[model samples]
Target: MSNPAQPDHYSGLLQGIGQRLHSARQQAAQTVNTLLVQTYWHIGQHIVEFEQGGNEKADYGSGLLDRLSKDLTALHGKGFSRSNVFYMRKLYLSFQNSETLSHKLSWSHYFEILKADDPLEISFYTRQAALENWSVRELKRQMKSLLFHRLALSKDKQGVLQLASQGHELQQPEDLLKEPFVLEFLNIPQSHVLTETQLEQKLIDHLQQFILELGKGFAFIARQYRMSIGGKHFYADLLFYHRILKCFVVIDLKRGAIDHQDIGQMNLYLNYFAKEENVEGDNQPVGIILGAYKDHFLVEYATASITNNILLAKYLLYLPDKDVLRRQLEKLLLAEQWDEPLAESDSNE
Candidate 1:
């Protein structure tokens, strides 16, 4: 065989060249994206300015958008359609703070975030999209899945405002939980009977989407984490390490209605983790039970005395009813006495 040094040198050279080229291309792309977003901002600023002038041109300035779309499409050939122009105008209005804008995200990212009715939400999603480096498609998926509302189930109005300002920080036990995770991406039909093994396998197969749904900083550790207590053996369903929480997160899935047994089992798992698995510097582990039907009373009673961080939340195989869920989530947050000094859990995924 040839000298190993020759191959090693060539491999190193190849990697170095590849890295430099990739970085250069990324820089060029960022430059182009920054310019494009700035251009759209200017276009939107001009449109808003024109609209505010009260020119009395026509009903709702409808003709202005049509005329602009036609002329700009003729000039730019792409990205200046009537709908796009409207989005541009919205982007300007939604975030008047130039400080909130990022060169990392494209105009498309802003377009999707504008769908949020709340200004704080728009700001939150924009920051999160940039911070997460989420693609346009991923950003849209999170927004459509109602990630904000899911998190909102635990946070009050001030907490909601904090979420907008800081994004979801996984500090508290409540912060670790996101209610009613939407798993529509798994392609499991509502009619399809899914076993625990099948559900775990599906989540593994779609790990990327699963992690995104789990929110920030959750890194999958083991599928069925094993722990033996005395002569008996137990396996936690799915285990993850939350980098932000600096603690282990255990998930137990239930296909049917969850009762006291589910909570007890999860509590056992959490105790095992805190006692056996936890090393120095790590915080107490948290457990979550995602069942088809959640009995809040059962969960509250089961977890009342147990100090281990645990939550019982509902899960839907199919997409959730956004309006109904939004109202329900709002009610949950509003009902809570959230006046305590709130500390959102910090995480990065």
Candidate 2:
């Protein structure tokens, strides 16, 4: 006998049990995080109170915390060490006011930020981490290399504030550029040499990670898309539709450094898509040249006079060392800042 009804009944019961378990797990995690955040808030409040109460007697606060930590550890168990109490004091000092506190960020996130001495940079990274929901590892990497400072150097005071308050918004073309796109998801070593086909295949296989690396609003359209015109044929490396930009993005991958010819090719592709392939409501197509390396001087000259929708950018197969990339971005920004003056000087000569 098949016993069809019995199997269906059991499967339904199991599914209900699984759903209940998932709900319980989620509730438990939420409760734990809430309690932890509440405790940190109280800790901050107490520290402020102690300091305001004129406890200026030499090292009185320190002695009090040392004794309290021992008693709390004995009573409650681990996680109340003296060093952690110091972190609580620093955390309170870092965020002096409650208005700036975020309910979404966890205590662990603040603890990590408290390790940094720079208050401005700490605040910047904290807000960014909360808004982006970055993992602890991502926070560590960004903070260690001073990602905020690098970006701030590229913009004026107002622009810096905008970047901190609201992250990279892709309303315009320049906003889509990040000097180095972190590709740790690829799991490839920085030193490893890979062919263009190999890189393309890896990106396709791990398409989800690739989308994240490309930043927000990128949705994959096709890979190795074919195109034919009159007597010639060409294949685009990858095609993506950016939801926010409301445009088709065509990407061409080059294994080596980019040249002027590459820019011309991408421009041709953009023109074809803009004139022939775009749907009724679609915006003009944008083409990007993704090469392993690029000469910014040559690229600027190559793309400067052109009005078509095309951008040239470098892509890395692996996550670059943060310090090196930070230096590179800083140099690039400085050069861009002096470009107008340099051009004028050259014209006068």
Candidate 3:
């Protein structure tokens, strides 16, 4: 005769204690992290104050940092090396106001955010990293991918500014798409030939990285989503659900330059998805045709008739040549006479 209720009571008590301990540890860690960040900010402020307005170098600035680093290392152990001290000073200059400091982020986050030279770019990364709960490594990955710069290129100056002030806004299809979508993480080379099937497989294999490249809120649905109409079967290359938009995204891959046929096929897929797959409370399906190259003029004409959110975009095997991409975007901006911002998905067919 054992007491079943007593065992249950003890188990519940243990669980409660464990939960309390875990919460306390988390709170303590956050407190320590916040204090450390503030300390580094103050250290940076002091170092900058020693330098002239934190920009012009004083005569003894180089040696001063070295001496301070050595002294700090002796007092506080290995974390205070010359580079670390330099970064602490940088952290101070980057976020000058105490009010701007974040308790949620550790100093490691600041170390990565400080790499951005542009102030607005820094702000955008900071906002996104916090909003997305991104680790330092994710922050580094995004910076290397030139996420902020690519997104900024697609917006007017005001929109770009808003991105810095507020994180990404996902009200429309264009809000979530990035043009000339970077697939460099797939490890495919420019010289390496990629077929549609092969590209689709690589994207699945590197699904996490691909989702990051695709922007946020995309959940993979099927690789070759099959739909039939009038006893004829057609396979979509890839299908995804965007959590934010609450709609399906169908992507068709092409190895060669884009043609009208590819766009027409994507539109057909969108129509099928809308009719068959959509349920109550779902938005209209959006289609994207991804190809190696697309003629801008042809894409413009092809997309003129469609009211639905069908878009065409170029896919890069390797990371884009940033210089060339910048030039092309600028050309697009000038061509439009700043009247309408070019939507990332509003290209190709």
Q: Write the per-residue lDDT of candidate 2 for residues 1-349, one digit (tens) a residue.
A: 6666787789999999999999999778867875786677678568667877987321324777787688989998987777777777676677677557666667777777777765656777777787767777767766654556545543655666677666555687656565544555678887888887888898899897677567668999898887886778888899999888888899888888988998888888888888878888888888877787877678779989888777766665554565564455445445556662324333112
lDDT for every model? 0.81, 0.72, 0.80
User: What is candidate 1's CA lDDT for residue 320?
Assistant: 69
Cα RMSD for predicted model 2: 5.3
For residues 1-349, what per-residue lDDT tens digits would candidate 1 score against the true structure? Answer: 6666787789999999999999999999899988888888878788878878985232224888888889999987988877788778887787676556788898888888887887767878888888788999999988887877777766677788888888876667788666788889999878899998999899899998889888888899989888999889899889999988889999998888998988888888988888898999999998989888876557768889998888877788877678875666555554455534323221100
RMSD of each: 5.3, 5.3, 4.0
Q: What is the lDDT of residue 333 in candidate 2?
A: 48
Clashes of each: 6, 0, 0
Best by TM-score: 1
Candidate 3: regions farther than 4 A off: 1-17, 52-61, 322-349
